[model samples]
Target: MANQAAPVRSFLQAAAKTEEAPLPLRVVQIEGLAILKIIKHCKECSPDPVTGQLLGLDVGSVLEVTNCFPFPTRDEDEELEAEGANYQLEMMRCLREVNVDNNTVGWYQSTFLWSYQTEDLIETFMNYQENIRRCVCIIYDPSKSNQGVLALKALKLSDSFMELYRNNNFTGEKLREKNFTWVDIFEEIPIKVSNSPLISCVMTQLETDSPVNQCDYDRLQLSSTPYLERNLEFLVGCMDALSKEQQELQFHYRILARQQAQQQAWLQKRRAENMARKAAGEEPLPEEDPSNPIFKQNPEPSRLNSFLITNQIANHCNQINGAVGQNFSRLYLTKALHEN
Candidate 1:
């Protein structure tokens, strides 16, 4: 049985290698039920992070998230971890019995102001990549959601970045050759909330019964100072983290420069000694030796950490950028109303 499986596995791998990659994800179509579940879970666990599994079909350029379920939150207990695994299996089995879409498309997580571009996030996506050919991570920011708009976004790691990550090589030269940067780490795909006919009908009925004035009270409310302040605080923290990463990269460069200088000086010494050996009619030593510890090229330090930090900083900046203008508008409106 093992021998037969080996041939089949090799054939599948060969086919995979020859197959062309699908187009980049164009849009994420999530059912209203899935969206509401995500919103409820995130809002209930506000300020704390939570994640879930996204179940759906990946057809063509569209990923339809038909359903989702939250993950069980357990700490570093082996027994509890086993229970969590079992829980997932049971959930999938039950869903399958109900003729629901039980396939795993990816997972979703609630982020704090879009701060989901960290090392851990990348590691999680890579873990998914091991089992799934193509998957996405859905990010829903509760803090941003409270301000009248849904802050849900779908993200998938760039193929180029993932390839380099699988090789565990984020060196400066490799990144330059591939033209990968912090911005290239994750590609944000547009999300569209798909509503079923029943859901649409229900919404229409609710709209008719709802007050015509709707949410004018909340709209005019001036409670943005605290939100803006919090965003600024996080932005500052990201900047500090970015500075530390820069320090680490700078330190690496200093060590690299010192190593290069030593290598060049050693090469010059070797050439001079070889010339003396020639004059003395003795056999000249080779100019380079791979086995020599001194001549061995230093393996470059990976730049993955720095790249993640840079991406985090960018997220914080964009969050602050959008929030600032909105806050300023609210503040001016409040002041004018007070003067009246």
Candidate 2:
């Protein structure tokens, strides 16, 4: 039979490195004034070896107070008086349980009323912060308590003040409006010394059995019509291709017209030289035999030769053409060419 391993040191020693079991939550109800309770828990044994307990917690520490309020003195004595007394008792009960530093000062009315001067509170909390798996602070605020009389002041604790400092570090105060909401109540007021620890503990609690809806910062990008990759590139390419085609077509048409005009002028010069030679009694040359060299090469006048005459034909022959109907065919030559 194999020897059993030596009994591990006490359970506490074994559990030291292991996570501390969750503590059973217990709440203390309070009435009257609002109580800020901040508690720091010390490591301790659980009632059952399997279970763990919470210790030394600072829920919230600032208490609020207001001036004398009107109570019914004549007709509505019993109900209002009972309600006021019950409210006061609950507020005090909450305050008494609040675990402030042994030397923590207590403010009264509106000034620095009393002093406790506690240093051990932080020491105890730092110890727990290092070892304890869970740390917490409990606070009780009635729905109606002098309209939140014991609201946390900015000077309550170093952690609370530091939190405020961090929050205000980069914020623009001038643009901020008066926002009164639950987040404002929790964040602005020094409810818990530093919200970081409380936040961590809350996250741990949620990990156990709750579904957490995580919040994330997401980025979205948008662009105008010109910047789209496919659409923009295609449009630019199409426009470039169309412009290039138009320029090529224009050049082709112009070159063809110029060549046609040059050919017509060369033909006219040949006819003029042949006509001059023929007028001196030389035989007229055939239209295509350029080497028969002695005859005039002038052929019958072309329709195009009367271009200028046609232009004047409308003005000169309009009356005659109108009277003769289809029989007004007559050739008109240029006046200067006829005289020559």
Q: State every prediction's TM-score relative to the real structure.
A: 0.87, 0.18
> Whole-model lDDT for model 2 versus the true structure?
0.32
Distance from true location, Cα of 312 in model 2, Å: 49
The clash number for model 2 is: 32
lDDT of 2 by residue, 76-141 (tens): 445755775565455445545764222112221111111111233223334444543334222221
Measured on C-alpha atoms, candidate 1 has an lDDT of 0.84
What is the lDDT of every predicted structure here? Answer: 0.84, 0.32
Kindly list the per-residue Cα lDDT of model 1 for residues 1-340, writing each as its tens digit: 4554444557778768755677667999999999999999988998999999999998888999999999877776558757877988899999999999998999999988777877889899998888877788989998887776678889999888889988998888888998888888888999988998998999888775546443455555567777778878887887887788788778878887887787888889999999999999999898777786656676777888778777777776777787777778989987898899
RMSD from true fold, candidate 1: 4.7
Instruction: Say which candidate scores most in lDDT.
Output: 1
Return the top candidate by TM-score: 1
